[model samples]
Structure formats: structure tokens, C-alpha cells
Target: MTAGLPEPAGFPDCPVCAYVLTGTARLCSDCAGRTLQPVVDPHCPVCSQAVAPGGQCGNRLCTLPLQQRGFSRVDAVAVYSGALKDKIHKLKYEGRRGWAMIFGRLLVGWMESHPERMRGVDYVVGNPTHPTRQPIQHIEAIMDAAYTEDVTHVLPLSPPGAHRLVKTTETPRSANKNLDDKRTAAAEHAAALTWTGDTSDIRDATILLVDDVLTSGSQLQHVARRLRASGAADVRGLVLARVPWSG
Candidate 1:
């Protein structure tokens, strides 16, 4: 039995430390502060991909100029490492669905703190996962939880629905792919993506794409392209974590 079990007043204990939560808190402030590493500076303004101090964007496959890429701007809450990584791992592999809401609430607070990133968003769309490939769609869950927790209505964003952008087919594992291979896989993955929601309202809407983590960022780029083709005026990205720049 866990020490924090039988939680008081039905509020969940902090997932990271089992500390009793007060107010509407999810992970305690201490845990959040300790685990969430800020994105390293000198990142690409367009995709939020980390870059060397004096070097260019780490994404080698991104040939298009900043203004021409799928998303106008992309931001992430933290670097994907330390305890936060473990939390994400549990959420994805251990069926810890409750963490989705916690992560969502955290995102709400993050968006609140960084107003510019979400300035004129119309819809918050989750990067979708194929049903046949995974039993649970992690990104969709995160967005749904975020929608439910945004009580203040700070950002003019609403989650359209889960799997709004569907992954029609499975693709190769990104980790196994080299830079050239990642680019190839990303292109194929983009071709496999399809939007499943109504397009009329989003014709010129400024949409925000939400995802769990930013790896190669090809997925978000693909989704953004699909949305752009569908007539979205501007598409932005907000991810929970980003892989730190190696250079």
C-alpha cells in the first residue's frame, strides 16, 4: 500500500512525490520546480528546436525558411529529462491516465504564464496516434484534460476533439532512425496523416497544435501542413517537453 493512499477529500496526491495536494494542484510546486528543466536558450523561434549557441536550427531536414514552415512558432514547457521523463514514461507505458489531467492542468498554467505563445489561437488540436498501434492515445488525452481544466478561460483555445488529426498508418520508430532516415520517415508519416474534423470554421482560424514531447518535430510539422492545407491562417505548437540540443 502506498503512503498517500486513501487521499483526503478525493484530491489526488502528487504523482511525483505522493505529497498531499492543496487547492487544485497536481504535482507539487517543489516537484514541478525540481523536475521541469527550462528549454535551453538560442533555440529556433519557429520550431523551438534547440540550437548551438552560434549555430543554426538543429533540424537539418528543415529546408524551408522560418516563415514558410508549417507552424508559425513553437514553444515547449521544459526539457525532457530527469523525473519529468519518468512521469511521462509512466503515463505512456503504465496506464497512468490520471497523469494526463495533471499534465493538462500544468499546460494550462504554462499557457497562462506565457501569453504570447498562445496569443490568437482558435483551436487546440492534439497530435493523434493510430488506434490499432496503441491502446490509448496519449496526446489526445492530454488535450482533453487541458480542456477540462482551463477554468479561467485565459487562452481563447478549445480542444476540437481527440484524434482530430488522425495517423492513418503506422510508421517506423523515430529513435531507430538516423537524421536522413528520420526525415524520410517523417515525410512518410506526414503523408499518412489526415484530419477528421470539420474544416469550415478553421478555414482561417489560428490553431495551436499540442503534443506530449517534441522529438524530431516532424509530426507537428506534418500536422501543421495538413492544417495549413485545410486553410488555417496560422498554426502554432505547444509541447510539454523538448529533447535538449546535443550540439
Candidate 2:
């Protein structure tokens, strides 16, 4: 005969660790920390790529003059390595939506550390996923990041929301394409988010846009153009990770 089952919340095994989680927390901080990779290196202001301590913004793909890009600046919370990468993959494909909170909190902490970034920001907006892609994990990650940072002013741009920006006809796998191809593809299938509803109130407002990762940054650029054209005074991008170009 088999023994009785364990009591409620008794000897709960950590998902990342086989050991029991005896503490009040669900996943022990020790095991959780293993997945986190703090962005210790100085990064490029344009692309969020880690550079030398006294480095210049030399990534030609990302370091184009601010006047030419969609958003003025972009920042990432962590390097796309270790635990962060695995979690993002699982969240996108495996529906591990719970990882949103973790990525969100990390983004909040990253913003807090760099107060200069959030200065005069009015609304926090998320990059919208297509209507067909039901569970928008990146969308939630942006919202969670804003909420964790106690950011009250946010724009809802996800599915089930009436007004949205940039409805992607197809899911463009950015990593699969070259720089020129990414830029071309981004421009080809672009219908900027048009708001029939009143957005007159935010005409002069400064917006902070958030996303999960920056691969080619073609998406960010595409959206920023729409926002700027919509009369947004300024738009900036923040992401959880900056995917270095594999090519």
C-alpha cells in the first residue's frame, strides 16, 4: 500500500531545485538567483549591448543617429543569457506566463538603479502582439514591469483592448533574418496602430515603451514611428534583454 499524500504546502519541492522549499517563499531565492544575470557591463545607449567600461556606442546597426530611429533611447534589464533566455523561450512557446512577474520585477529594479532613464516619462506602453497570437507574454511583461515599478500611467495596447498599435500580419522570426532583411521585412508588413478613439490628451505626452527582448530592434523602430506620427512628444524603449546579433 502507498503512504498518504503530503499536507497542503508541506515539503513543496522547488521547481528549479529538487530540494524542499521549507520557507514562506515558493521558489527559494538561492535557486532563483541562479537564473538571474545582472547586466554588470556598461551598455550602449542606443542598442543596450554591453560594451567596454570606456566604450563608445559603436554598434552601427543600433547606434544610428537618434534622429533616424523610432525611439530616442533603449535600455535592457539583463543580458539574454542563462536563466533569462530559457524563461523567455518558455514564456513565449510554453505559456509560462508566471515568468512575467520575475522579468517585470527585474526591469523595475533596473529602472530604479538608473533613475535618469525614467525622468519625465508619462505613460508606459507595451509592444502589442498580433490578435492571432492569443497569450501575449511580452505584452504582460511590459505591464508587469510598469506595475512593479509603481508606474501608474500606462497604455493598454494588447489584445482584447480596443485601441492598438502595429497589428503584425505575420509573426516575423527576427533572429532568422539578416539586418537588411529585418529592416525590409519590418517596413513591408507595416500598418501603424491607428487610434479612432480620442488620443488628443496624450498628444504632447512622453511615453516609455517596453518589450521583452531587442533582437533586430526592427519592431521597436516600427512602433516608435507610429507613436511619433500619432503626436507623441517623445517615445523611449525598454526591454528585458538585448539579443546580440548572431549573424
Candidate 3:
């Protein structure tokens, strides 16, 4: 099938595993079978995590940090574990940028499956990475693949040189951190964020913020808040993965 614009003549390899593809298949059968574990039913409507029988949605508590973020809702494609997590690590660390194609396909498929998620969303934006941080912005690649053909959701994928949002200072990693530590990191990240574009489009618009994963949600919290402050009427999240609540 046709790939991202300028619409490649053909896609010859499985993006996830780099296996040679024979037909229009975007991913190898092996990789397809093992990955893309979508979040399913009996889940929280707010956070989309699985809800135990007769127990409340774990996120029902008002004190949860995500509740206070600018976004009103979050929809994720899968739980961040197993094969999916491994592939994300490879994409982010090993420079396997091609895997973004599979992620884009997954995000597109998720949007199709849940049509309501796109309702009234004016733009779909990937979380911008700092220019000095990496050789390629992985999130932008995924967004390009997912919405390239559909301009309704697509915005020009921000290159390193021109990002609407810039991370002014590097913050501590959030992995496995305590709640207080995560908050500290989020504060630092938020404080360092800068806006670099015309706010005319953002005014009274509803935005769908896309990201690879949601851990402590420090990244999304700050980005969404900035967007809201720029006059985004509503900001929602569409993430590829969510770490299952460890509590």
C-alpha cells in the first residue's frame, strides 16, 4: 500500500521487524501476531485502564495527577508491556525510526475503531522533541504516517528546526520514580517549555495530543497546559501506550 507522503511508490519492508515484505503488508506476520495489544473493554472511560469487576475505575479518585492536567480525557492503544514495550524501546533508543510506520498504522486503526475520539478534534499533534535530543523526532514520524493523507487531523510535522513547543531544559527521567519525584520533574519540564507559533489557530480549538507512551504523564501535562493557555478550548490525549496502574 501507499506509504506516507509524498506517497512512496511502495513499502517493501515490515516496519516493526524490518522483515522483507512480499505484498502490501505493512508489518510481518510474526510481529503483527505478537504486538499491538489494544486496550479493551471494562475499562475506565476517563483513563482507559481495565476496571476490576465490581471495583471502581481505579482512576475514579479525584486526587490522581492526570485528572488535574489540562486534558479532559485520554485514549491509549495498548498497555506498555511485553513485545510492544520492547519495540518502543528500540524505536526511541536504537534509531529504528521505521517502526514509526507501524505505530502510525496502529494509531490510525485505533482512531477508526473509536470514531468518537476524533469528534471535534481540530488538529493532531505529536509531542515535540528537542532538536539536540536526537537525530530524528520519532513522534513526528509516527504522526506523519498516521495522518499524512488525512489533512483534517494532520499538521505539518514539526522538524527539529521549527517546533511549536520547545523543551528549554532537560529534566530528570521519570521512569520508576516516586510520585513526588515525578511531580518535580513535571514542574521542571513545564517551567522550561516555550511556545513558538501563532496562537490564532489554537484559539477556541480542540486539540488531540499524541504521544508514544504515558508514564508519569509529566510530558503531556505540561504540553496540554501550554496548549490550553494558548486558547485551546479542550485538549485531549491519544497515546500509544499506558503503564498499567501498579497500585
TM-scores of all candidate predictions against the true structure: 0.79, 0.71, 0.75
**Model 2: runs farther than 4 Å from truth?**
1-35, 53-55, 61-63, 134-137, 141-172, 188-192, 195-197, 245-247
Displacement of residue 53 (Cα, Å) in model 2 is 4.6
TM-score computed on alpha carbons, candidate 2: 0.71
C-alpha lDDT score of every prediction, in listed order? 0.69, 0.60, 0.65
Every candidate's CA RMSD: 5.1, 7.2, 5.7
The TM-score that candidate 1 achieves is: 0.79
State the weakest 10-residue window (summed lDDT) of model 3: 21-30
- Which one wins on lDDT? 1
Error of 2 at 51 (Å): 2.1
Clashes of each: 0, 0, 0
lDDT of 3 by residue, 120-208 (tens): 88766777665556656677667666654233543334433444556667667666788778777766766776656776888998888
Q: Name the runs in model 1 displaced over 4 angstroms.
A: 1-13, 16-31, 50-55, 61-63, 66-68, 154-163, 168-173
Q: Write the per-residue lDDT of candidate 1 for residues 104-213, one digit (tens) a residue.
A: 77787677666677777777777766666554677777777777777665555455364456788887756676877876776677788776768687799988888888
